[model samples]
Structure formats: C-alpha cells, structure tokens
Target: MAVNLNDDLEFVDDDYFDMFEFEDEGFEVNRLRREGNSAGPDDVEDASKQKSDTSALEYRKGKDMQGIPWERLNYTRDKYREMRLKQYKNFQNLSRPHHGLEKECKQVKSGSRFYDFQSNTRLVKSTIVHFQLRNLLWATSKHDVYTVQNYSVMHWSSLLQRGQEVLNVAGQIAPTQKYHGSSPRPLSRVQISTMAVKDNLMVAGGFQGEVICKYLNQSGVAFCTNLTDSDNAITNAVDIYQPSNGSTRVMTANNDSYVRVFDVERFVLLNRFPHSWSVNNTSVSPDGKLLAVLGDSTECLVADPQTGKAIGSLKGHFDYSFASAWHPDGRILATGNQDKTCRLWDIRNPSQSVAVLKGRMGAIRGLKFSSDGRFMAMAEPADFVHICDATSDYYCTQEIDLFGEIAGISFSLDSEALFVGVADRTYGSLLEFNRRNQFHFLDSFF
Candidate 1:
C-alpha cells in the first residue's frame, strides 16, 4: 500500500515520456479516465491500425526524399555547359581579325605611316590678312566665305589657297555727285559686330544697331535699316533663321535690352521683345521655335522665337554668360560664361546642366557646334580654343594655340575643316585646320 509512485510508473517507456516532456511538464488524468471508460476492444484495434498506416506513409516519404532528381540535375548542367560554349565562341571571334578588316587596317597604317605626329603641322594655304576679324559666315553653297573686320566685308573663295580677297565692301559709300540743294549727312563708318549669310544674301550688324543686307555677287547694298533709335546702340549678335517653307527672318540682340526679328527678303520688321538686361548673344534653336539667349544676368533664358516670351531659364554659371550654341539636334544648349566655363544644358531638363566644360584663360567669347554636331569649339578671350568631341559626351578635347586673342570660330558646312580668327594686331590671321582621324590604340606597337 505504501509503494513509491516513481516505481509504479516504471511501466511507461522512457523515450515515449521524453517525446511528450515540456519545460512545465505536469500530468492531468481527466482525459485518460474518460478515454478508458469509452474505449472498447474494437476501438483500440482500429486506433492501432491507423497508427500503422501513418507510420507507413512517413517511411515512404523519407525514402522518396533520399533519392536524387536526375532529370532536373541533367537539365541544369546542360544549360551551364551551353552558356560556357557561347562565351568561348565570343572570345574566339574577338581574338582574331577577319581578312577584310586586316587588309583595311594595313592600308590605313601604311598610308599614314609618314605622317608627322610630333610636328602636327600642315602646309598653310590661306592667310586672311585682315585685323580684328569679328565674325565669319559660311555660305550654303560652300563656295564663298565672308568675314567682317574694321567695318568692312571681305569675301573669299573657299577653294582659293592664298584666300585672295574676292571683294571688299567698305562701311561708307560716297555719293556720285554733291547735291546743289541741302544734302543729307553722309553715312558714318559702321563698326561691324555680327554677320550671317544664307544662300546669296549676307546680313551684317553694326555697333550702332544697323542691319545691312547685301548680295554676295552684287556691288551696291540691297537693303539697310537702323534697328534702334539710340545713337550709341550696339548690336550684340545676329542670327538668320531660314525655315523650310517660309521667308528668312533676321534676329538681332542689341544692347538696348531688346531682341528684334525682321523679314530679310521683305525688308520689314516682324516682332521685337524686351528683356530686363542687355542681350549679349542669341541663337535660334534648330527647329526655329525657341531662342537661347545669354544676357548680362548670370542665368540664360529660353524664349519664344516669334513672340519673345520667356519660356524657361537655365541657371548655373556664377558670372554673366556671353555666348551660347545649340546642338544640331536642338535638344542641348551650351552657354559660355565669364567664369571660364561652358555649361551644357539639356532642354528636356532645364533645372541643371548636363556638363560643365572649363577653359584655360579668359571668359568664353565664342561658342559654335559643328553642322553635324560632331564637334564643339569654344574660344576664350585670348590664346586658347577648345574643340570638344560632342559625340563622345565631351570626353575628347583638342586645344589649338594661336598665341593671340580669338575673335570667333567657324566650321565648314561639311565639318571637314575648322577656321579660327585671331584678333591680335600683329599676328592677326585666319587659321585653317583639317580634321584628321586618330588611331590612338596603335601607339602600343611602338
């Protein structure tokens, strides 16, 4: 009657009790008493059969898990092998050059083998003897190039080696005979500020805000008009917009804080828009819908070309911007600043610049993009002209040293040659450089 409970519980299996053990282990006998009262011999036998069936299923599952997936593993291995094979083929193709490519490369290397890389000099065919060359305009026909200097227009043939001056038109034309009655005052000399040419029509802007039009082949003037009433008006820049199916329009930026548009063929004023500050430079977008303008302010503005309404503003430069150029595609703009940097802006996102190009010496006085948008030339106040490869995200840069002030820069319509106008009095000359292709990787053979 006094037997220990631990000895009486020896009928329970240790492993079976261990499976049910928890940290707060305690036994309640109410469920076991109820089950013992309700259970019969047939119910106990059925419970034993269910337990046997569950154990058989668990054993089958474990056996299945022990086997490997041969088909799936084969597929993965085949895919990896195929990828490696492709990589090997690509490497073979790149390692060896083809017959045609090898021949072409040999020809190129032999033809340019004698090229003087150290000197980097070409024969000087033409020398523009004019001093203070302010602007250059290349005609559409590609036969004539125009330059402005000292209130005179000099026409030169593009094919001329010596650049023989074809025609020289002075700023003033004398009257044939003095009038007997009271005669009008003779025209004063025009200090040319800007020039533009399209087809055979040439237009020049004067320091006194005069726009003069002349025919490339004719002698006398075609039309002339004063764009401003002030006696000391300065025309900062002139641009010609020739739409596909419309008349040509002349756009002029003036020191009087206004941009004027005129019909060149009709000789009539079209529209004039006023600005808060003096407009230093203006460039019409390629589509002729927008105008990129640099002014006395630190920020550049884009405006409607026809109405002169301000559309947007690009702000990044710390000093006043004096020059601007548009990519041929018309989506990008380059603004030259007095801070010695040219900021390139994406018109789609006018909030910030896409890149900032720095120069060596003074303020950027001139900026021009090649007609094909392959190269961009930025001229500083003196001694430095930077030619950037626009097609390369502006990574490749070529500098030209002329040892003088840079008046302006122009590229031939085909972009095969570049012309830089040096403004120094003693060394004033026009420089021509033919663009040469470079094979930089071949240097390793040395």
Candidate 2:
C-alpha cells in the first residue's frame, strides 16, 4: 500500500514513493538475527564509530552525541542543509499563494536555549507507516518513550538504555474483552498509522481503521477493533483525553469524514461526529468543553465536544491541516498545515490567528505543547524541530538541527525532557533534550 497523502491517499509524491520499499529486506534480516540473540536498533557498528565514540547517554561533555558522520556522507552539515532547503518539496493538495501569511509572521529569533541537548540513542529506530501522519512517538515520563518500529510498538527506557516490544501487530489481533458494537473478526497484518499514549492508556490507529487499546501496566491487548470497512477508511489520528465528566475517552479522526469517540472503561462506542471533509486530526480542549477538528479543509472547526456542533471556525490556513494541539490553559490552539506554517489562535476571538510560524522546509506535520504550558514544540517533516517559548508569545525559539525524517516530537509529562524520533535508515535514532533550568544541577546530586 502507498503512503496516504491528502487524507484520502489520492495524491502521491515521489519523495516517499520508495519509503516502504526498504522495510521488507531489513525486517527479514532482523528477524533471523533476533532468533539467535537479542538485537536492537543500536546493535550495528560501522567504521565511522572509530572516528568518534557515541552512545545513547554515555558520552562525555562536548562530544558529538548524534554521531552523524558528515565526512562519510561527502557533504558538510551546512551544505546538506542548503541542499534540502532547495530540493525538499512540501506536499500540497491545493495550489494557493503562500506569501500572504508570510508577511504577517514575525521574524522569530532562534538563539533561545530553553532545552539543552542531552543525548541520542540508536537503540530504538522509529518508523512511520504514513508520511503525513506524525503522532507516533509519546513520552509518558522523562525515562519512558513509546514509538513504532516496523511492525511492533517498542518502548525505550533512557535509564536502562534498552528497548522492549510492547505490542506486535505483525500477526493477528483480537480484543481480549468483547463488547457490543465490535468487529466480529480479528484483524491480521495491521499497519499502525497513528498513535497516542496518555494516563497509562495507549491507543494505536491502523491504516485499516483498526483501533487497538492497551494499558502500559497491564499485559496483552485490552481492546481492539476495526473502526471502518470502507476502501478509503484510514484512521488518521487518535487522541485520548479526559473530559470534565471525569470519564476517559478515545477519539479517532478517520479519512471516512467521521470522528468517533469511545468510552475507555467499557470499550464501547459513545458518539460519532460527521464532517464534510476527511478529518485528519482532532483535539479536545484541556477543559474538555471544546474540540478542534482539522483535515482536508483549510479552516479548522471549533465545536462543542459533546454534540460536535460547530461553534466557531478558524480561517487563514492556505492548505490542509494535519496536526492540532491545545495549551493546558485551554485558551490557545495551535494548528499545523501542509502550507509549511503553524498558526496559533485564541479561542476568545476566532476572527483571526494570533501568530504565524514558518518552517525551514517541508510541512508542519506535528505540534506539541509541554504539560506545564511553558513551551510549544513544532516539527517539520524532516531535519528541523522548533521549540518556542509559550510564555513569551512565541517570539523566541530554539531550532534543533539534525539529519533525518522526523517521526514525531513529544514532551515528557513532567515537562523535564523533550524527545525527537528520527526515521532515517542511516541516522535512525531517538534524540533527547533536557529542560534547562537552574535546578537541573540538582538532578546530579540526587
């Protein structure tokens, strides 16, 4: 199957046409090696390792933690960055002038150091099934991270410097507990497209519209089902949030132009919201009163969470939106678009956006707000991840430069660490950045 672009998989770009071509060969080699002994993504050692020693978090100060051998690649870091800027193409469904909002954006300065680079671990290679979907990585705490690696959902630990398979969808999956309104048959060879982890509950959405829910503390699959049977039925996004009623819910945005909410406890369908366009992503407000829906349309809808009624519409985006995030304060909403921009909107006045942020290259595939509401991280499709100061109206930012396609960006629940997943075959690894503060020294003492 081809990578789904434009929500309906109607558009295809050459950049990602050969993405899945290299997976089968790699998977077969790794499968045979795993039968003999345990081997992770960090098991390989190349001649470049003799040049400079690097490991997950075992490097001395001032050493290159990423271990990228620019000399071997025959291109300097600066030269490659320039090449990507000129050659990388941003996928777009609509041909519209992009310079209109560029004038309104402020010249964002990039010297701010809110988070400092800590380490990079090749122990777990992050992979994405869909090129446009990027919510694959999730950090439950400063030490634990969950990401997709081929056919398995792998969990990596910064403290242990090792990884373990959490869920494997390479075979068949059936719900452990059956409930009403469930699929009768089990799903085999499921390919996960998007995932979200929160409050000990992890929900993964597949390309075949399969919703698989698992609890980190529990064993085996908690619940699993195929959400839609349509030919174009792809689960684009999954979000787990607790509303004001204190009940846990899972919301899935599907290419079938519907957002389905499920009760977590019973694993039963609660409500379904219909949309005019394919819903790429949906986010409920922190208070659980409002919902932000983005998809094939340029405008994002702010609706009542219960009824899914359109209370307001945010206009100004030039292309399709793939990501949406809400601040903890519940007043600000950030939407990422294929137009290579992320716009911040104020809920009180939905007439226009408060700020417009541009990307280095490619589209803004993911947006994340720190749990403390202190910072916001925006990720492009590759190489660049921007961290902005949410308290300062997003004027100051720190651009993290690396070489790889970004699988996802996630902030730890405590807001102490930021994790970036690189999906490249050569530099495929997980990068870590610790929150910079005066109390950081206290961690060493502990």
Candidate 3:
C-alpha cells in the first residue's frame, strides 16, 4: 500500500525576501519529518504522480508559513550623510570668491604695515615681525614678497653725507608676473609644503593638489588675484626647494608619489618624476641640476632637474623617511627617518648610507645645510637640535636648549645666519643666528 504525501514543499512566503527569521518554517519541516506527514526518500520514484502533488503544495506555502513571528529589521542610512557634510563646510565658507580687499600684498611700504622687518639696533622695543615706533626703518611687508633693504636709521647723520647714494638692496628685485590682477580659480587645498617667495612672486604647492602662484609685489597693484590650480601637481608639497637656475625654479615632492618642478612666472608645468608611496621631501643640489627625494617607502631618488629623469633610486633609510638635504658640494644626499636616525648617501650609490647620525627618539623633521656647507643641522620634534659637520658623518656637536618640535629651518643666503621655525603646543616663532655669532629669537613674523 502506497501512502500519498503531496503538499509540503513550496516557495510562496510573502516575507520571503526578509531572511531575518526562518524559524517558523524550520519548525514545520521538523514536525512533518518526525510524524511522517511529508515525502521521504521513497517519494521521488513515481515522478508522474509527484508532479500533481507538487502543484497542490505550491498553492499552500503561506498556509504552512503563517503565524511566523515578524522581527523588525534594523538599519539607518542618515548618519553617513551628516558626517560628509560637516567635513566639507569650513572650506566652502572661506572660499566664497575673493572679497577684493587689498588684493595681493605687493610692495610692502617702508614704514606702513607693508614693509620689511627692520632689525635696527635703534628700535627701543623689538617685536617679532615688526619693530617699535621709533626704531622701525621699514615695517614688515604684509605682502608675502620681501624687500632686500639694509639700512640703519641711527647712522644716517654720519653716512648720509659721505657722498653715498642710499642703497635699496632690492633695487634689482622684480616680481614674476603674467598679468595685472589676474585671479584664477581657488583650490580646496590650503597648506603647501614649498613656498618660493622672491621679489613679488610667491608660488606654493600641496599634496594631490594644483601648484599655485601669487604675485605679491604690485604694491597696492595686485596681479594674480586668485590661486590658480595647475595640471602639474604634487601630493603634499611635502618638501620644497629651489635650484639656482638663475630663474625661480621650484622643486617639490608630494605624498602622491612624485617629484615635480614648476616654473613660477608662467605658472607652467615644467617636469614630473614618478615616486610610488609617500615621498618625505626633496633637496635640490647646489649646482641646481640634481634633486634628492627621500621616500617614506625606504629609498632615496637622485634625478636630473632638466629631464625629470631618474639617475638612480637607492634604498637606505631603515624606515619611512622624515627629512633630507643636499650636501654643499651636490654629490651627496642625507636622509632622516622615523627610525630615529640620519644617514648620508652618495648620489651614485644611494642604496647605502655612508654614515649614520643617531640620538633622537622620534622621527626627524628638519634638515638644512649651513650657508658655508661646513655643517648640516638636523632637527627632531624634541627640545634639542643636532648639528653635524659635513666632513664628519657623526653627531659631533649638539645644542640642547632648542625648544619644541623643529618644524622648519633655513640658512640666510649669505650663510651668516640660520633661521629656525618651530612648532609647539601653540603656534611657534623663529630662532635667529647673526654675524656676531650670537643666537637670538627672530622677531616673530607670525
């Protein structure tokens, strides 16, 4: 005797798409299997009869699925929308088309808010970025372009009559400009690594953004009014240095995996060298022909400036690179990294660091060759700065009183002065070294 079991397997549950709860149907199947109410392995042999039974079952799946508990599904899509909007609000507000104030700060007037910082000894009170009322021969220029003026207000009575025409060191200074009051599209990027400020021309670059140039010497007559983005871009402008090509040629390295050169005047795309991973910074050779790019990927790249072609890529830094500079002679490159050390390399065989300068606990952030190339100053985020001789590859001398993380540094063109920009809990100021070989605080320019 054959017992017919025809209506147990069908797919018509209304809440089928909601796989959240399948418990009710699971219980039904178990009960039927245990009580012998549904087909077992023996039911498939008679295919013709099974077809009729399967059709009847298809029409009754909901009947079997009824009374299943409907648990509510949980998920919301609004929280993500709120986060993205807040991240982009501040940039939108500050970028509301230039309000046309002073335009770009061009010629900083001698005594106005727009002149050079007069480091005169006569200034009864010395302030950072400015001198006091009676002492300032020329006020610091609000314009980013600085004037080369060396004058002493107190010695005027003696030198003023000695058959001498007043010398404005900036008599030959000229701004790099394309047109008058030319404003281009503003960019999303604000901070840039390298800034080339000469005469009245200022060019800056940032990570994965366009290269930008500003004309700041128009006195009140501003030229490039807006920051225009360029096609030849960088990742972070992580490291910026200029070669002495006699023209303002800015070399930049970005985290975006490349080193680029920008022609400031035309704002032209000069050259690009591909560097994968994060490039720490770039150092231009003394001859202005070679550039050394230290990579966070553990390598140093030496390349020809004119060709954007790599002479070689060498691996030396044990860990991610943090800082680097060119030797005074241009044949050697030096690199610092998160590994807590600095290393010297030969451009020809950059794969190996010839010497290691060690001591810092944190990654190095600042490195600069002294004006005479006799020494290189290596700085970390700590309170002290390290000084190493160009000839000796070790930490020969140290200055312990330096404070905060050394964020940036430079030597005066004359090599007679060293300038350091530091970063601490609050905004920091500069440290100065003068001809008297005396070290002092640079009047903070803020």
Candidate 4:
C-alpha cells in the first residue's frame, strides 16, 4: 500500500480493483480551484442561506471523507484503489512459500510412522493416546471453542446444569477482532506431536514439516509469525527440539534431507548434518550429545550429529521404523514400527537388535523412558499407555487407559508425571503417576 504522511493521503485494499481512474496532477489543482470558486466566500449567515450552504457542505464532505478536496476526490479514489492493489500484491508476496533452503534437505511424508520409540520390559502393561481434530488445534474450553477470528468474551455467569433436576447458566459472550492481532492465528501448522513451552517460548516439532518456535508476547494469545509466512523475522521455519529441560529452542530441519542446530531469536542455521532419507522425527538424546533421527525411505541412517557421518542403519522394522528413543545413558536406541513390533538397538552397534517389543497389531506410536531409566511407557494406536520394565524385553507390568486414541505420551522430567494427548480435544493432558504407580488426572489447570 502507498504511504502518505502528508495531509493528502490515499489507501487502497483489494476489495475494489478496476474502479480506479487515471488523471495527471495539474488537472486536479485546477479542478479543485474551480470547485472552491464556485462555492464562493463563506456567507456568514443569512440564516436560511447559511442553512442551505451547510447542507450542501455536509453532502460534499460526505463524498470526500478522506478529506481530499472535492475535485481531488477522484485522484484520492484512484490512490485508494492503487493502495488496495498494492496490499493485494503485498499479500501475494508474503503468501508465496520460501523453498526452505535447509541445508542437506530431504522430503518425507509428514505422518510417517517413524516417530515412536518403544521399550519392552517387565515394567508396565498399557498406555493412552489423545488429540484428534477438525480445525486442528485451537484448544476448546468448556462447551465452546475460541474460533480463529472471534476472540469474543462471554460472561461466566451464563449457564446451568439440569439433571434429575435442571441446568442453567448466566452471562453472554461478545466476539470481536478487537483484541486480535494483525493476522488471524493459524488453526494449525505442521502437526507438532509434542509442543514444549517454557517461560515465554513454545517449541513444536512433529509433522513432516518445519518445527516452529513461537515467542509469546502480551498479545491475547501466544505470538509468532505462524504457518503463513515470515516478515519481521518471526515464523515456523526452524525445526524445533525440546530437550528434557523446558527451555525452548528450534533445530534446523528442512524437508527431511538435513538437520542442523538453529537459534530461534536470530534465525541463524548452524551445525548441519545430512540424512540418508527424509527424517520422520528428530529427538535430542537424553545425554544431549546425540540427535536421533528416524527415517523410512529405503534405508534409515543414524549418524554422529557432530561428525555428520553415518554411524549405521538400523535394520529391523519391515516397512518403516515408526518410533525410536535413546536410553537416558545414551547407550541404547529403541524403535517401533507399522508392523507393531518395537526393536531395541545399541547405538555402539546399530546393526544388531538387542530386543524386540511386540504386542499390538496396529502402529505403536508413543514411547517414553522413565526419568530413572528403570521403566518405560509405550502407547499403541489404541487407548492404553503401557508401563514396562526397561531392562527386560516387553516386560509390561501395569497399564493406564488414556481414554482416547493415543497420539503422544511422555514422562515428565522428574518421572512423577506423564502427559498424554487426548484425541477428542486439542489440549493434551498432564497426568501424575503417584507413588502407588497409578495415573492421576491433573484437572486443576482446567
């Protein structure tokens, strides 16, 4: 759009395009002067005459709200039209996708099964899964949803519950874009199976796309450029990684071909590593030295992140290595796949399988090693999250029904807690495993 800080200003949006008129400048001055002269000097009142003049002035002013002189109204109109055109152009420029030039890039299908890392031990029995959607993720609250555009407010007093009795409520909500930002928040970006939020930052990584680092501001919601595009240096271009620590940092993963360390605030890319196939998932090692990347295309390669050389290819899963994880000590790597079996590999020798975890027939997608590295939690395509002994193969001793299709699961930093994604809602859950080793619903935050 055109910028005019001067008295004469013009702004145009794309709503009306072909209506602009073209005229040279001198014509505008002469025309305005002519209109001024026709109006004559202001006759201070002949009450009736003044009334007529006032009426005419009001009508004229209404036609020139931008405050441009009557004759220049046409020029202003054209300026507005041009402004609109420019805005449209600007939108187009921003909408175009930047072929992300993440170094050593490889493309992979986003929902590939290569993200789960399972452990079979004599530990637990089952696990849970949650998180499913239509508009993706705009966490629904109570009986209503906060839409993308309408950040409205509703009075909390507005309802009731009728049972053998009845239900009622009070108050109402007023939805408006008033508190909204310059753009509508995206309902979804790449499916970030895990979103790690710490302090003011939220890091997401999952879908076979870019990991996004979202910086929160005082805005009504979190602040980040979003899935659309990046201007002014904020966006979803970086591959995000959330180590056990809550601090948010984005890794560089473009396509699936390469992986690199990325600094969120500066958008700087560093420490690039090439992958043999498109990466299904990137997990930071518990020790923080290794980055485990699960790949599916043809050969799945695991390499020393620092050296950028292939350590070896994990061979076990028939179709693809759907899920994998590194032991806390960083000595072992475990993988789950579409065939419904989980394999354990020793990183020192990736070519051999030390153990096989089997049970379910469908995909086993979620995996977690207890903070003590003594127990493991694994979830299948079903509703259970299984707790297993990490030392022994497939040694599940207990289980918990997450009550929905399992999407993701994790043990908290202290192993005292577990988070499971609920399929029917956008917001996942925070469940605590008490000393009795039972899962407790953490509903206080709700």
Better of 1 and 2 by lDDT: 2
Q: What TM-score quantifies how close candidate 2 is to the native fold?
A: 0.88
Q: Could you say which candidate leads in TM-score?
A: 2
Best by lDDT: 2
Q: How many clashing pairs in candidate 4?
A: 63
- Comparing 2 with 3 on TM-score, the higher-scoring candidate is 2
- The TM-scores, one per candidate, come to 0.64, 0.88, 0.51, 0.48
Clashes of 1: 0
Question: Which residues of candidate 3, in runs, are more than 4 Å off?
Answer: 1-184, 192-201, 207-210, 219-235, 238-246, 348-351, 391-395, 425-427, 435-446
Residue 103 error, candidate 2, Å: 0.5
Candidates by lDDT, descending order: 2, 1, 3, 4
Report the lDDT tens digits of candidate 3 across residue range 1-446: 00112222111122212323333323434554567756564443232122211121232332111122323223222332243233321111012232321232112112111111222111011111100000011112221112111220111211121112122111122223344333334343222333334344444443224445444433321122122234433333322345665776655555456666656555445676776665546767777878666664656677777776778877644566656777777777777665556677777666566666664344555676765677676665444456665554442454433323343445555555444443322212334333333232243321
Name the better of 1 and 4 by lDDT. 1
Q: Which portions of model 2 miss their true places by more than 4 Å?
A: 1-63, 180-185, 439-446
Over the stretch 178-260, how does candidate 2's per-residue lDDT look in tens digits? 66764435777778889999988999998878889998888878888888878778899999998899999999999999999
Q: Per-prediction RMSD in angstroms? A: 37.4, 5.0, 30.7, 23.7
Which of candidates 2 and 3 reaches a greater lDDT? 2
Pairs that clash in candidate 2: none
List lDDT for all candidates, in order: 0.58, 0.83, 0.42, 0.39
Off by over 4 Å in 4: 1-194, 197-201, 205-210, 215-249, 252-256, 391-396, 425-432, 435-446
